[model samples]
Target: MDKLLSLCMIVRNEEKVLARCLDSVQGFVDEIIVVDTGSTDGTKEIAGRYTDHVYDFTWINDFAVAKNEAVRRATSKWILVLDADEYLDPSEKNDLRSFLTGLDAGQPLGISVPIYNCVESVTSGKFIESSAIRLFSNLPTVYFDRPIHEQVVYRDGELPLRSYPLSIFHTGYLDTVRKEKEKSSRNLNIFKDLKGLEEYDYFTLGNEHAILKDYKKALYYYERALTKKTESMTIFPYCRYQIVLVLIEMKRYKEALQYIEDNLKRWPQYPDYYSMKASVYVNLGFEEEAIELYTTALTKADAPAGKDKRFWLITPSLGSHIPLMNLAKLHQKAHDFQKTVYYLSKLVTMNVNDHLVLFQLLNILVPNESVASVLNFLGKIFDFGRADHLVKLLHVSLLLGNKELCEHFHQACVKQNIEMLAQQQLLYALVFNEPDRFERHLPEAGSGSSTGPLNKLIFLAAIVWKREDFSSYLSPSQDESDPSLELLQSMFATLFHPEEVGVDLPFDVNYISTLLIDLFKMGYYDSYDWLIQQYPQYYFILANILGDYFYQNNHLQLAVDYYSLLLDQKQLSGPGYYHLALLYLYQGETAEGLQFLRSAIELCSHESHWYIRYLKHSPATEEKKEIARQYRDRFYPYVQINVVEQLLKGQA
Candidate 1:
């Protein structure tokens, strides 16, 4: 009488966890039938410790077939199917031992066991228990089918399988959700190749699609799966979630509200349902309502049992950062700086690596003269290697006019060979009213040859405009034909006047222009005049900068002069005319501004239509009444205003 139970398992590369799993059940089961389906790890060697029934089977695409093969190889009266990442807790092992002891003398079928799935928490790095069903009967009366989400199908002609309280601890799908996603994708491709995939196949495909973030396709498949008339409400709620997610992605917030309301009507305790509702409210700019929903989600998070009630469901993970960050932004947008600072501070505590949170914190905290507090908080939580944090610290120091702190951070950046640090250092020098300090580092701007062209431009822009005199660096042969010169030209072209180019440049040209414009806008008249006279061909690049600087700094007369110079230039182009129109309107010369705007409309043949609309609606020009009529009659005939209107609406 072979008084034994054979443990069956199908495995691949499970070397990292196979030993632990086998050890957990080795005492309860007599013979372990470890079925290897092309495992390239030390899994076979590790499996040898518990049993000698290890055998190899060629992998077919169908997992059900592989599992069935494993069941057939067992020689004992009872068989237990397990995975390489699954284990039996001590209590579960004792339960199984007791069940086996009391097994009917002639019993051939097995019992279903409860499974507790544990996932590693992304925030705390701890494991939380979820639930599933892993234990099942080994008798031919019960079989599994389906290519991907294989279900245990019981044959119609046998005693009903018994379910026990014995629970399996599943670590297989823990941090490996990403890997399971890949497996699902592979299964999807296989199902797609088949002649006709059933409704179940569509559900599995939808699950894979949802995991991959292809929400529209996921919704399509889910809707199709729903149409199959399945009675399983378990899959229905998940499908609804996927549909809501798709609507969210599509930015159909108003439509998604109905779905959320319907979902809550049925499953009121679902945490993710609340999270989705909150997300929709956030998109619709209902910040107060969104916050309320999120608060409600926090209360209901722990209501669900099993796999759905993990840390991700209860406490916010990295996924929840966006909503919290948005709420902070909303406070900032509403001019509630204190609330903005408070929320940003909370976000920084959650994850210090989030540069956006650090930026927002600096933006709010520095304006309120709370730089020291922010710096101290950041120092406590963040490691020093984060370049973005260092940059933000330097920015905050500059904002507070603390040259000593700025210099300290600048040195740290230099020591770390962070190229952006050089740019930040230059900005720090300029902001603190110390141009000489920036000039001292000018020669070393391009010293790091490996630094990208964009970084070098930032360095050069800082030095050239910040220095007291522009004529000192003049050379007859400035290597104007060099690739670096072209890059510089392209950078300026896209930055100040994007209408001149058909496509946007791949670097931060606006930042470089901003730095240069700031120097001229701060009453550096000599430098601005000298650069304009020397680089007349590049004058259009300086026009917007000059106009913006003067307009912002209350030097409207100087802004008028720059705008006039831009209008006089033959290479002023379409955007140049628009800027000139804006400046004239700003200077109370509405009629002249309207004429310049009309000229811009004529030049709009090669420019984006949005620029034309901008010119038409510009209050800075006096000719809007006439230009509006002219725009309707003359330019509207050639321009695709409908498409341009849509693009304008999108921006608004």
Candidate 2:
């Protein structure tokens, strides 16, 4: 414990994250050395609180200079470098000192630590991991090099390296942080001004371009990195990898496929290359090849990665979750439930906290199986006893419309004495079809928009009794291509905004079609009819479901009225004609029944019942006899067909 590690950081205007950074590793380090380069904010004050070694240097637009200055002040044997926006993961704090001392002495001068770059919201669990030489020997021979994306270089040629399991979370790349600093522009401008740059500079410039969404420039720089004289550069594979990504983002899939195919030959051990190749094949519409490649990728997923110097940029999920998730999605699109479940269940087993995958899995299983069976199947993947697991289960269950499962999870929450969220109560009531419970939680229903699961059920319940206050809950759902939220937002658009047209409902067309029939049962026919007329393309769905509902309810007159509309509109099929004829017959309208029965038989000529009824009704004129003779021969003589014709002849 003789001052084994010193925390060295270079900061400028990082007051927001400086304290959080220093606080995370302060316990692990012997002393803190901070070099401030023109921070006009409270960055220095916060750094001073953690260490007296806070020294200010003139701004030189070079990261290496500031970082070297911080390293110069360290009294410890080992230097642990960090940025103001980066913090040592608290869970990994205790492992630092033991890991430093435990390192095989005199072998590795530079120790790379795993850094997680939080790309979006920190709470979202979305991040990319990379290794950086943050830990190094504090000897004078080992100092920092490069201006941006700086690296630790030993004075006497190539430095022996080792990777440590030091988890550091970097928030500098977060959108809020990026916008505050305008750091992308700063980095890009710095890279742009430099000439006669190295392979690392070109690679770093490519990343900067990619950040700015200038894919062409990114591709240009990445290619330049590959073409440079540095053949054995550690970042060479990454340069090629980034080139493929830039090509992909530009939708140049064919070009990407060739480069990635080449990359696979060189770095065949990395599963991400296969995954990327599969993604390219997907874009090129080679679905089977994509599937085959993804499966092949699984075989190589366990290949030594990140730990290897040749391919340090290993995405852990690429080998397992990425390929499995892709395969699940592919099989799901093909409607192969068995394979979809097989792949998704694998993903769920790996990451139980993956709620998106859990939702997709439940979506497949919940609709076809019983609640008990689904819960049992999911129980293998989840511990229902845990409150967080129970909450996720309850959420996904609601999304899948598994009422009993939602109830089961909700009740489990109750057992845990967990504070039931208003949203949870709303979902519980909605799923269980309890109007009273739903009303109790109405005020707390944060989102009742037409797209939300809560609103879908609320809208269904409202339109079920839609004669009541349904309009207040309806809003125009903007389905800008995010699949989970893409719903038939405009299903009730007619009722709410009658004049709005041409906003087609893609995902929830069936939901609204069935809802229309339910509304008709509750005497809410006008609104549903308006919905159908607005998107008249779904009239066949409305006709089929509404006709069945009318028949099932013993409402013969309403059935006749609805069917007559279909017949009048020429939307009625042969079965629809026969169905209408039956309704007329039930109503004792023999003449109308005869006309529709003949019309039914004319279109659905194979129905012997229609032939038998038609023959019984009409006279045996030559024209009628001709119809009978034709149907009998054309139908290849079902016993009913011959018997109906012969019996009619005998009666004549």
Candidate 3:
């Protein structure tokens, strides 16, 4: 039979993947040409199973040389060259053959096949799609170049390259395989030995350095590559993109911005440049600008064909995923929870395995919206096998006050081997309202078996349920001299024992806050105080809740203390500053009070009225009034300065 297609490959110690590659293209090609470059394994024997024409070649450092030798031995109209780690997708085989049947041996031409490069472990990891000219006419002029990262170039004529739907899966770049092969070190050594470097040689060297995370060297070579880049060089945009990445990695945001801006001007339609600019904006805290740029990048993400080969090297089809996730997180950071949920929902539709996005969406939704609303959405996307999703279901059920749902999920969690301290706490809280049920779940009070941390936590739960009145332990009129040290000391003794506390107490902020709020509701103020006093390290959770609690209850001094603790921990909310300042003013600390007022204005300008109230109360000098007037004009420009002016004049 007249040969139509020749499958050409160079092998060395590729026995592990050789059979899989050959099996994928079993009946697709006419002849197989395997060029063995000194294999020390069963690679040649495996090659013998697929083809009878396995030839021996001396091992050299140059991959191009070995690859060219395989092509040289092919005797067909067309050649399909690939690495042993790569295989033609079986689904794409028929399409590939149909496309090939339409072409003739008129001129040297190449078909750019999409390559999916898997990383980490193949079964559980992600892939990056790239395009490579692995299929071409069997012309003597078409050959590979460079020593390490080779490319097929038609030296005799202009090889008109076109993309096809055919795809290949390459797994040699997987972390597990790369670790065993040490391919980067081998490529780097070969790259270093090459003399009279071309533009691409520099780029390849930069890529090698990038793989090793030597950003400084990568940056230098990428810059050098750009200098030598020709007007028609397809790699120019990729080099620009990589230079920006290297700059960003080096924390040189200023330089990265300049380079990206210049590239965007030169290649305004390229989404990759805009995507990078958005990242730079995020790094610099220009979140709104980042959101704008990311949105702009999404609009331009559908990259046009024949623009650049490097563009096809990455999965341009779903390149928007990166910007989408970035926008979701940026909105999350800005506390635009609606937009956060919107983007995260979109991401979940694309990949349900994005558990982090699911977790983030659930976290915001359960607190902001009703339980029914969250449950309705979770029904569509929930996967019980995912422990994190079970955790979400457990929390949502508890939040809805659905004891039956909580118990159902509790059994599901245990069955699924999902054991968490938060789960136990939630279960304990579900039955705390019923005396009999509460005691049923709670550890025996004062029982020696309940001395361990887990049981001690249960004992605490019992106290919250058993004691409804704490007024006697906490009263303003209590005699300071009446040191009823007995009750206090007994409480301290239970808490102070280190061994009694379980090693695996899940001190999540939400769960801890929930526990504290339950105690406050049941009038167990002393018990709440005991927990906070004993675990002062976890007081940020309590402080956040208590700050608002005290402020709303008109307990100014208590509000001030908790808010100050939160501020010291960098966990203060937008209203925390204003509340703290108001408390300070109530205590006659005018200087500190005004300082926090300014902070409040800077943080949330729309809430400047909070600061204005204190200015309306405090007797301020002209200097203080001028400071307030400036802040109002700067942050809240729509507000009338005359109103503040009149208040400062003490006439209003």
Candidate 4:
């Protein structure tokens, strides 16, 4: 006789995905046991289609109790526990059947199947695989443990377990599903009643709070877990990792570093601790130290024969790939271009589908190559990914003066039927600077209006062309073109007569910056002045572009006004301060200029060549020279100020 298997599950309002889970195992399982705990939806009706063993259970707010109740009704020799959102792959059905049939009839055993928890990220989707003992012999002693995040265990029987390559795809963690379920809040409420039961329970509480972004609360519970004196804790490493992560989230770098240092002797082989230490070092501006720590992490992670060869779920990839990425960033920060490329190339091989990495590679490589080489490289590497990413590639193609490549990409866009109206508008208005091309992609006359990517692009193009009839093209009548265009009419109203429009609506700083740059390029001073005059608060974006534009065109007073407004906005750090300082010096405001110049050097000493040069030329008393020396010493350790000083002297 063939061995029988019963599918046992407890569900509530899982009507949406019930059919899918049931159909995957309908042919294999002998009996289907679904215990509904008060479902108002078509869950019961759907379960009825699968099997007659559907039973209703009372709500106890205890997952283990409900799960155990479902399993108790199973009559088969073997039991398979599953959730509503989880299912075995259809392709693995035959293999699962074969494995179950081949099991020893005399043995009391279970199989640890891999559960691939699928989650969709901004760019792509990936699975986080974990092991769970879902299949077991139907013994009365074998049952689930805990109220939430429950696990399968046996009471008195020694259920020997073996691993299987079989996987169950889990969708409960998906953002779309989780928003409706709010599982973390539910779990948190359930955990409130079950606190102080075990050290592992404290860890789960920390995880729940961490998901809710309550890092302070999370840290408190994590510390509580650490305080628990257990002889041998399996989750101790994970607990340490979580504590460090929470500290980092709070930006308590000093506390985090001290914790890592204190624990280094105890958990020497854990790569994530080292990774956390490197992060703290980076935040503190200790670049060299960060690089060394990141390197050490990579070494430990890749070691073939290490004493502690265990991997934990909390930071599965920290030891493997994140270290390399961090190392790459540190090299990039230190301006070590070749080393940056080397690490990034390694990352590319590891994550071939990473468009951001591919884009970064192009950014670094394109500047050093000729137009033909860049075009050839783009053609060889550019695979159709996100539309926004492909748009950026087109912009890069235009920057390299490869019109043919741009046209090729345009043809590809048309072939793929990808709607990239914003990109096409940018290509015309910004890259090609052709009014004809800009006008070609405008929305049809009868199409209704709303604020969207395409409509925003249209507004940008209209301003660039200085089209007299642009308002007619952007009719306020709500006919029907783009849904997101309604909020942007205030921005567009200020286009022709900015002084007349109020600054109640918010406009994208980036979009405004691009528009300001274009208007400055085209010498449309009236329109540019109107825009800045209307929205005085968002002057940071306008001021930077206008200040530089006017400074380059020798409009010193106007440039000073724009730059001074930027300074007034508390934006006087790094490049903004440096440029404002130079402008003040040009206008002969020596005292005011020197203060701004000092701020620039203090913020980023690596780019302090000109500031140092100006200080050297100015009349400097002993006290002023000492102050200058202090500023230079504080910010310019990595910068070759002496080399810059010598070069300036030689020029003089």
Over the stretch 1-652, how does candidate 4's per-residue lDDT look in tens digits?
Answer: 2447899999999998888889988666888999999999999999999899899999888999999999898888788888999887778777777888877644567778777776554223355456678888787777888888787786875668887777787888786788778988999889878854677788878888887789999999888888657426656766777788898889666567668886777767656667777777666445566788888877767763454464423344556567778887767644567898778777765655665665566557655667577556555545655565466666555443345556666666667676555444554454456777566656442243333444545665666566646555554434344333444565676656666756565566666765665555444566667656656776666677667755544455777787777677776446667667765665678777777777876677665344453555466455356545654565444223233344234231
Ordered list by lDDT, greatest first: 2, 3, 4, 1
The predictions' CA RMSDs to the true structure, in order, are 12.4, 15.1, 13.2, 9.1
lDDT of every model, 2 decimals: 0.59, 0.71, 0.68, 0.68
User: Where is model 4 more than 4 Å wrong at Cα?
Assistant: 1-59, 69-132, 157-180, 227-231, 262-270, 306-316, 375-406, 409-487, 497-499, 502-511, 514-541, 545-571, 574-652
Candidate 1 root-mean-square deviation in Å:
12.4
lDDT of 2 at 572: 73
| TM-score, prediction 1 | 0.49
Pairs clashing in candidate 4?
Answer: 448-479, 448-480, 448-481, 450-485, 451-484, 451-485, 451-486, 452-484, 452-485
Task: Give the TM-score of each candidate.
Answer: 0.49, 0.66, 0.60, 0.67
Number of the candidate with higher lDDT, 2 or 3: 2
Lowest-scoring 10 consecutive residues by lDDT in candidate 4? 643-652
User: What lDDT is obtained when candidate 4 is compared to the true structure?
Assistant: 0.68
Quote the lDDT for 461 in model 3.
Answer: 52
Q: Give me candidate 2's TM-score against the actual structure.
A: 0.66
Cα lDDT over the full model 2: 0.71
